[model samples]
Target: MYKDVNNGELRKGDVGKSITVAGWVSRRRDHGNLIFIDLRDRSGLLQVVFNPKISSSAHKNAQMLRGEWVIQVSGDVVQRIKGSENPDLPTGDIELSADKLVVISRSKTPPFEVDDDLNIDDLTRLKYRFIDLRRPKMQALLKLRHDVTRTIWNYLSNQGFIQVETPILIKSTPEGARDYLVPSRLHKGQFYALPQSPQQLKQMLMVSGVERYFQIAHCFRDEDLRADRQPEHTQLDLEMSFVHQEDVVNLVEALFSTIVKEVRPTNSLSEPFIRISYDEAMERFGTDKPDVRFGLELNSITDIVSNLGINVFNKTLESGGTIRSLVLPGCGYFVRKQTDELIELAKSNGGKGLVFISIDNEINSIEKLSYENYRSPIKKLLSVEAVKSISNVTNAKPGDLIVIVADDYKVANNVLSNLRTEMGKRLKLYDTSEFSFVWVDNFPLFEWDDKESAWSAMHHVFSAPKQEDLEYLETDPGKVRAELYDLVCNGHEIGSGSIRIHDRRTQTRVFNVIGYTKKDIDERFRHLLDAFDYGAPPHGGMGLGLDRLIMILGGEDNIREVIAFPKTQAASDPLFDAPSFLGKSQIDELGILFKPTD
Candidate 1:
């Protein structure tokens, strides 16, 4: 090891003791007779001073140091001057007085600076991820991720959960997302798909009587990318035998609560996470993953809007659609431009437009009281009674702006859901001081697939239907709910799972409901069904997206910030330049060909 002392390990107790530190030079300053260099390692940064009288050669070498130059220095720990101390740093009170310096590796000028809170282009940062990880902020993020994961491992291990490793190469199964298939070189025309979540293998563990199993598993999905998603990601996959839905939920809730309190003491998590049905969550927050930290709950004003005699509202009602709205307090003073911008926002989200009713009592109010009157672009289309009903339904106040969307059920909720988040951000309504975990329970088993002209699993085909709803599986499949649950925090779905269909008969029925023929089921899932023949325990579990959880805990908007080597939104690795072309011979070995469209 080149380093005997980490830069962050220096303290007042070590004063006057010589130590060797190895790291990259973060910053350099020359004061003629004396030079100061900030040396950074993965641990942290420490200031190193070089005096010509101490060692002329070392002082000269220090003067040559520039940003991000790798070097090792032997120095004595000394207290920094009280006036020059950096209060923000943990080792602010100590500095290294160098007597020897060695340049291990010198670096050219970097494409971007290595520091905290840089606003560098994402592509540039990703292209030079190696240097990017050298930043203190990135280091701290990765460290936090490691610590959180460690906490989970310790907690689960103490609870008799055996850590297990599942296969990376798995057979392709329909699981909502496209699969990234790996072509087999030896087995001609055959391929293995990367495991999406270890969903089935973990169940297999339960059937083999592992009792409790856990793994930090890698999952792949050949799908469109988003800020929080990637083609390949990681999850904390857990499973238990003879456990019901409540057992799984309680275990995960307790485990994650412990992780948050231990790994991130700066933030507090609410005790006893609240659980609500999926329908209730959507009804209240316009999303199944409700952020209960703030109250911008969605309201059904379609009943009120339908009676207003407005062409838009009546037309939507006649078409079996609905209306929804939310109230933002003290936003009635918003100017026309601000309201128009919101309209465009809604339109972009597939709504016809946004209806903003500004109840600015100062300028427009008769009684200077609740729903006295309102100033809005569509005020002419609304009667006084209709306006009063809207205000009452949405609980709009004198200074509140009522945002209404009239469209199909899904569209209205989707538009208002996005608007709610945007408004929360604009009003600074999020309480970031604590984590608010919620359990959204019992999602519908299947959703209509217009393109496929069939029903598709809402969670997955493996999820067991609620026992009471089993009778409605074939007749009222859309109404049949699964024994599924999602763990959400700060408006992000952190984890999800369900009771698995263990028996072959029930599994076959579920596959049938999802429009899969017996041949289709046998071809894809026969391995799992065969395992159940001997004996399968009542098993279920959830997989939490480790990257997403880490990103949230690190207070980052993008998961890539916490990930050391992450792909860009385009699903490309800028650093490695992956997804490159394969040689013709290699392609021929797989017996594949590329064709161009005319």
Candidate 2:
């Protein structure tokens, strides 16, 4: 055996015991005669010492070792002298006295050092991912992901869920994102798409009477990428038959709470996550997924600012736009440069402009405030009555900064949401270690797709509309609400789910509203539609983003930190050089042709 004990397993108790350990050189230092090396493995790091007095040959071989050289050492563990032990390391109390050394492998200088705190570019780290994963932080994240998956499996299995392995290749269907298609070499002009979420298959399991089904699913998409997205990702996909939206939500809430208790004991999580309607969330926070830890809630001053004669506000109201404001406490002293920067921020987020009114000194009442107490670009345009009404509505006080945006409803809300998030960070308004989870519910069943001049399902076509609103499917599709809900944490939507349409009639209605013709429905979802005929039970579930969940748990801002080998933001794999052009011979076998490009 190459190793009898791991590098980090040795301690003061194991002193005077002989053992063999294998690891890579983490650090090496040569003091005149004696040499010291920090050996690292999956467990942790251990300090190994080579002395000429103990073994001349081992001491000679250790001199040649450099960073990241893999080797095996037969050694006796000895306690480090008092005050010489490293308090930061777990195995620092004992040192390995090498009697023999064998160089198993050697490594060339890496593109970047395997250090957790090192600042390395994304491309460089990804191109050499093998070395990148050697860092302690990366290793811990990999372990955390594994632990999360294991916990999910155990919890679901205990709840009577059958772990089913769904097919990787599936029939192409419109599941929101674009599909990653693979050519079928044996069948010309045919291609198989990677499953986006096992969405349809899991529902089929209900038809087969599985009752409860789960899978750690690998999903693919050809969509644009971001810090939280990748070309391919994994999800905790689960579906339960004979369930309502509440049933799914309760199960998931319990499962996640248990995981947090067992895995992240230090972080605080609120029990019985706060629930808010989609409309209310947007009205108060200007976002469906809001970070509820802070209180920069958006307030509309559209009515109060009407006829105020500020050109921007007056024109916005005339065009059916709204005026929204966010009050930042104690930011009344902002200078012109700072306020200009904020205006730029608002413009960047699609707002026409930003207006700031700061109250510089303490005032007993809004009526008492005049030009002396206010600082604003349009202070001269607003009458005392109008300004007082705005202050009363927004609850603006002395030493507060009122930032307003006059634009379309969507743009105004969106711009204020971005500014609220930024200011929350600047003010340290919330504890970073706290996980605030909320359920954003009551999303519209369908949204108007102006670009396509048609209606599109807001979440997906399969989502069941509220029974009371189902009558509007034909007459007023926009008025229908679905049983859709999103699980948000720390301002990110980590999971989404809804009660699904299990019958062909309701499913067809949704499909029709989304501009799908009979032929298109038959060609796309005929298999799923047919399955509903054979006693398909009502089912609903969620595909929890495993990557995003772990990212939040691990306190990482990017999902890539939790993923072992994630593609770049541009959706290209730097390590494998994926999305490359296909070889001519391979393309020929697949019966494919390419158009020449300039």
Candidate 3:
């Protein structure tokens, strides 16, 4: 055994007991005849002292110790002097009196200190991730992740959910993002693609009569990367048989509610988890995944500003566009430069421009308001009555700035959603410590793909349309609502799911609606469609992003912090140097060829 007890297991109660401990030397200080070192293991740190009076050999050995040198020590646990105890540590009240020391392994100076929380660069940290993981902060995050997963497994197991493992390689059918395809060595010119999600297999599990199934599933996507996204990821993939829309939602709600209470007791969670329709979420917050912890809700001001002789508003209304405004409190004093930046922000988010009406002075009533009370470029074009109407609709106060966007409904809401969240961040509007979970349901079953001149499944082809909306499948697909739902937290979409089309008829109809030909359906989704024939029960479920969930719980802004090893924003791994060129022999073995570069 490496030690009788872990370094962190030492305590005042264990004083005077002889024990052995092994760990990396966190820090070492040499006093004249004595040496002190903090030994760190997976559990935590413990202070070990080497004195000539205790053992001259051990004292001499400790003198050669340096940071990150792995060593094992036989010592007696002793209580520290009253004034010398470190209250910051749990084992601070006690110290180890070392009588012997063994240098198990030596280490060179690390690229960065593990004991200090320095602002290290991402490349350096990732390249030297082995050392970075030694930090206490990183260790705690790893433990928190473990606790969360363990809690999930226990909770779901108790709920009669069976743990199932699915295949890593799956058939390549369009989910949304491109797939990371693996070339088949034995089969000429054929390939196997990594699973984006176990979407079909879990549904197949339901067909196979696994009443309830779950997996900590691995998924891959060859797509652009961001702080919250990666080339590969994990999700809590689950499906339930004999279930409806609410049954799946209720199960996920209960699972997350239990996780938050057990793993993150300090963070405040709203009870009953607020539910909103897809339309309501997009109208009020401008996004289906809204951070409801703070309110800067979007309000439609087209009715108020219509026919006011303002060319911007009138022209927008004339072209079937909508005008929406959101109030930014206390930003009424923004200078020309600040407002111009906001205009650029709007333009970047696919809006023509933004119109700002800054309320400069206080007014008790609409009758008391005047032209001079508000500041806008178009103030000369508006009467005091028009301004008051706009203000009343958006509930703008004396010190609020009303930012209005005039564009098509889709572009207008998209722009405002970005602006709302950006301003919320700059103004520190929402409490970072609070988590707001919302369930947005009733998404459209199909969206028109202008480029393809055809209809596309809004969530996925497997999603079932509402029973009442089936009539519109052939006549008016846009009006058909699907049984899709999403689990969102603090403006990040954690997962999406829906009641699946379990029968072949509806499944075939969805395939046809999405522009898939009969031959295409028989070729691509033949296995799933064929399985539905044998006896697929009414089933539905969700796949929650495991990394995003942990990132939120750990109070981290980037998902990379929660992930042990993650690719850079450009989807490159610095440590392994992946995406490298393959040798000629290897490429030829896989029957692959590459074009010559200039």
Candidate 4:
């Protein structure tokens, strides 16, 4: 048997070459007189022909070959008879004239097909991920993910960034999300938490004179799942000394732009991405991470709608609420059911209800509601002046639909933002290949925590407050903006970072603002606090979610597709059946006990 005949190296001119190929049977076609098997390896696919006239013994064995069977074949490469060519396959012009065949291993019927076009449940595919990896699409995604990682590593290394390892078992500090804690056997009742990111460590490396540091870090967070979120994921964590927020941002932008050009040349990126302030993004798009690819921007109509005497609007304004509207071009054709569905979606995001007006009808006043016979229930509540004001504010024209939300500013904006995304999807308003990247700066240093009745760090306690806002930190922490920035692409927050607090006084003050007492701060972060005693350099960095970044690059919805052995939504690994029970002896050694409940 030939030892090596990969799919890519085959050519029609190599007809006289003797070859050996080992692969899984992609497909098996049996004619009465002849048998053909499509063999597939990671590289690609090759066709093998078994003619009984040439070798009856080989033909008999080939007849038993089923889909996905592991086999080895010794063959003579030959050009296919002109009519027998398969124009679809890469190696279609030639076929393997088999002399011998050996079944290396047999496979049972798979739970699902391993072909690229098969539609199967994700659970089933994840359960049998090994087989799923054999599919062309999955294989390509994994390879692409590898290439992306390699390119990033090479680029960073060339740029003098040193890859450093950070500890996985770290002391947990408050960071907005629940940490995945690891039980410490030696310390009885004490635990070490898995890092949500290498936020502190990378900064410490800079403090220790590492100058520049980066790690393709694995982070764990005990959080609920979403399409882009996972309990355990990876990030390209990096930090640099002697830099400001702009320096870090420029470095990241250059890296990503280079990656895009190298990995996905077909996709285009705007030169020098647009910059948007957090307030401006929220004002125009109703979201801080606005997808700038589309133009259905949100507009305020509080003054016009509040004076119209519409109960929803007047009540909202009376209660210190705001009214905002988004005009969907050509959405006036939506039926009653679609509008009702949109209202429900908005309500779920904390809105009271959605009030929509179809501008397609020419009737201009509440009194002419019966004349135009609009589909919305609020048609009779608005005055002619209010209608005209709304149209002018939103630039609404014939065949336009204006969806308005009246609630507290935060609630109204959030609800309308989500609804805008939904409408974009339903109406096919977004371009899949379009990447609209922007920097979201001026993030609030601390957000008011209603539950705790205190101020909490919006990004983290170590993030530096902007110099302009530093004066307000002691007086009004709520109004202070941090030197934090988020890399947002097409409405997805891909990465976040900030200028770190290098001075001990500022750092301690930040903790105090978050209601951390001196004792509590020392107890939780004594090492970090102590490290700052030495002369620490000014440094800053960002962590990009590798899984989410790959998902975006590959145009995949789920992060699992880009991850090789990703856990399900429940945070369970089906392949290894991890998080399994340990034996009593092992548990006893760790001094652990589970109280079984009746």
Candidate 5:
């Protein structure tokens, strides 16, 4: 170690002690005869002063140094002059009086400033991630991520969970997201897929009598990218035998609550996180992962408009549709142009258009026609009584604007849901400091795949069907629910898990229900089925996206900030320029062929 005394630890108490320190030059200020240099290392920064009277050679060498030059100095710690002390830094009260200086390495000026407050594009930052990581903000985030991982490891270890290493190469199953495949050298026309979540392997581990297992595993999926998503990501994958939905939920709640308290003491977490069924969430918030930070919830107004003569409402109800609306507080003064833009926003999200109605300031009675200020063309078709009834259902008050969507159930809900989220941002209704966690349970086991012309697993095929809905698996697949749970915080899904089917018979039944033939099931998951024969215990597991969790903890909108070597949205690394072409001999040995097309 190059001088163990950290920059931050050198304080007034060590004023008279001689010490050696090593770090990069953060800044250098020369005042004719005296020079002050701020030295920075991972721990922190400290100010070092050298005067020609103390050591003429050292002072001359320090004057020639530039920013980011790695150097070593032998010095005596001394308190700074009272008037010159800086309170912002931990070691601000002390200064190192250097007698000797040794330049260990020289560095060229960086393309971008390595300061925390510097504003640089993500592409440029990623290209020079090595230097970027030197900044205080990135260093803190990386350290916090490490602490979170360690917390999970310690917590699981104490709970009797064994850390198990799962294979990176596995067989690809035809379900869920697209797979990232690797060519197999020994077998022609065969490929090995990267593990998506260690889902199958964890389940098999439980079947093999590994009662509890966990892994900080890397998962790969060849899917379209988003700000929070990556082609490859890390998950705290864990599984436990003889566990049910409640058990899994309890374990997760304990772990997360503990993590929040230790890792982010300032953040407030909801004790016993709110539980809402999938249907309830869709009904109230219009989305499975609902952000509970505000109260502008969607309310059904279908009953009020079913018999109203409004063309928008009548035509929608006639075609098997429903009407829903969200009332924005104190937005009645929005100009015509603003209303039109909101209407277009709703249309873009699959609605015919939005009906903007404002409460009239003068009249407050249901029978008064003068009490309605409407922006939609269909307003003339609605009577005073219909407007009052709709307003009553939405709890609208004077100066409150009600935006309505009338169309198919899914379309109306989705359109208004997006509007609610967007309007919240425009209205400044979201509280960034507040964290609202909710558990969305009772999800549909299968969803109809339009392109495939069959039903597919909503979570996964192995997720067990709810006990009460088992009889409806074949008779009424749509009514059946799965034992699935999602831990959502502020509109993002941070983690998800489910009680899995440990019995081979139940597993096969699920595969069949999803249109998987026996041959296909046997070929894809034969190893898992074979393991269950000896005596498989009922098991379940959940995987938390580590990068996403760190992003949330760091108050960052993108996961790239928390990830050390994150790939871009295109899934390419700019720093190393990866995914490049390989030699033909290497491809040939992997039993692969490449053909270029013009």
Candidate 6:
């Protein structure tokens, strides 16, 4: 028996009681005569002292202990000596005096320290995930994920949502990215692609009269990765039969409000999460996912600056484009180099250029003009009304910098959104301790794909078009809005869902709008179309990315940190050596081939 009480459970009251404890040696300090060890388990750190007077044999064994060595110790819990307590730890007030020690297992010196802040290289951490997960931070995050999932399960079950499993190997109707295919040995040329999401299946569940359904579904997509993206991920797949957009929104609001209060008590979540329309979010914050913790909002100055004689402003306004500006508080002292960098960032994000106005009296050195050199060279040429309107609209005061971009709405929003997030990070404007959750709804039904010269689903083809916008689905697909909603927090989109198209006519119209040929549509969606034939219900649901949501809740910048065995950014599993080549015979049997040519 290696344990009666956990190392972290003892306190000053448990002094003089003998007990057994076991865990890895988190830290060891030798003082010649006495040795102090901090033993760590998933619970927390416990200070254990080995003294020669108590047990010479245990003291001798403890002397050989080093960092991360696995061992078991029988000890008497004792209060720590005065003035030496670690107020940060739960078991700081007490120490364990070792009477017996056993070395359960030995470990090699780790490549990096595990019980410290996450400052290790990413690849190394992924390669040694076993060691990394042993850290208290990782353990706590995993526990938090578990608690969140368990809470959702209990909450949904009580709400009469049935838990169901969906098939992983499904025919690919690729939704947003390239499908990850699995070559079949039985069917030589045919491949089964991993489910992107349980999108179609959950809708089918609704058609089958499952009043409500939920699953922790595994989804896969072969796509470029980002800080919050992975090749394979998990989402909370939920659907309810005969529900409106508001119903789903209310349900999610209640579920998450409860989860945050119970799971992330530090964050103050709004009772009813803030809701904004898609266009409204883009107009106000320059992005659909706005970090509402700060005041750097993107305000429109198109009407104000429309008459400005500047060529860029004139051409953009004449071409039916918009002009916007972001006010960086107290950044008016920017030098030419800083302004150039902000311009370069704008150009890189597909904007024509950027115009910066330092409201401060800092004179432009290159222009070498007096303190009256205007806010900028371009501002010097503009009407006073334009300048005053921009200042008044954006609330830019002295010592503030107003960064302006004029282009098509999409390009202007793209450039300013990137700049807004970057500036917020650089200026340390966001309160790290705060969590702001908003629901962005009414997304565009279709987005233009210039290369393909066609319009495709903005959320997904399954999403139902807004009833008011249905008239424009065929006439002007770009004008149609979908009843989609996204849960966004801290400038990152947590997840999205929508009221799905349930009828054959609506689904077929969506297919046509996305330029899917009749033959292709019949081949791929025949079953789903057939299900709709069997009396599909009016269904709407949402799938929140568990990893990204947990990442935000855990105060992590990357989703990989929250996942236990996440693959590298390139979609290669370092720990298990996955994406590895198969044997020749096995590969031949599956009819897989490797060829490269241009």
lDDT of each: 0.87, 0.91, 0.91, 0.86, 0.87, 0.88
TM-score of 5: 0.96
Off by over 4 Å in 2: 362-368
**Local accuracy of candidate 1 as per-residue lDDT tens digits, 1-598:** 8988888877778888889999998888889999999888887889999998888999988888888889999978988877998888778888998999999988999998887778999999988999888887888887898898899889999999999999999898865689999999888778999988898898889889999999999899999899999888989999988889999999999899898988788797888999999899888888888888889899988766776678887888899988889899889888999888989989898889988888866644423443345777787887666767777778877778999888888888888888888888889997877799999998999999889889999988899999999999889999999989999999999999998889999999989887788889889999899999989999999999999999889888898888888888778999999879899998998887789868
lDDT of 3 by residue, 1-598 (tens): 9888998877889998999999999999889797899999998899999999999999998999999999999989999987999999889999999999999999999999996568999999999989988998888889889998999899999999999999987788865889999999988798898999999999999999998999998899999988899889989999999889999999899999999999889989998899999999999999989989889999998888888888988898999999999999989999899999999999998999999998875776545778778898887887888888888899988877999999988899999999999999999998898888999999999988889899998888889999999999998999999999999999999999999999999998888788788889888889998999997899999999999999999999898998898888888888888769888999999999887889
Q: Candidate 6 residues 235-311, lDDT tens each?
A: 99999999999999999888988888889897776556788999999988888898887878898888788766678
For candidate 2, write residues 1-598 as lDDT tens digits. Answer: 7999988878889999999999999999999589999999999999999999999999999999999999999989999989999999999999999999999999998788889999999999999999999999999999999989999999999999999999998888865889999889888999999998899999999899999999999999989888898888999999999999999999999999988877799999998899999999999999988999899899999888886767888888889999999998889988998888888988899887899989876687677887678878887887666767888888888888999998888899999999999999998999999988999999999989879999998888889999999999999999999999999999989999999999999999899888788999999999999999988899999988999999999999998999998989888889999879877899899999877878
Better of 3 and 5 by lDDT: 3
Q: Candidate 6 vs. truth: CA RMSD? A: 3.0
Candidate 1 overall Cα lDDT vs. reference?
0.87
Q: For model 6, what is the alpha-carbon lDDT of residue 407?
A: 92
TM-score of each predicted structure versus truth: 0.96, 0.97, 0.98, 0.96, 0.96, 0.95
lDDT of 4 by residue, 1-598 (tens): 4357686568778788988988999888899678988899988889999998778889989988998899999889999997988888878889898989999999998898878878898888888999999999999999888888898899899989999998999998765689998788899878899999888888789889999899999999999988899999999999999999999999999998888888888886776977878888889988888877778899899877766667777888989999999998878888889888988898799888988887655644333443253445686676555666677888877667889898888888999999888888877897889776888988899989889899998878889998889899889998999889999887888899999999889999999898888889888888887888898999999989889888988988889999998888888888888779988888787777899979
In model 4, what lDDT does residue 409 have? Answer: 83
lDDT of 5 at 259: 86
Lowest-sum lDDT 10-residue window in model 1: 363-372
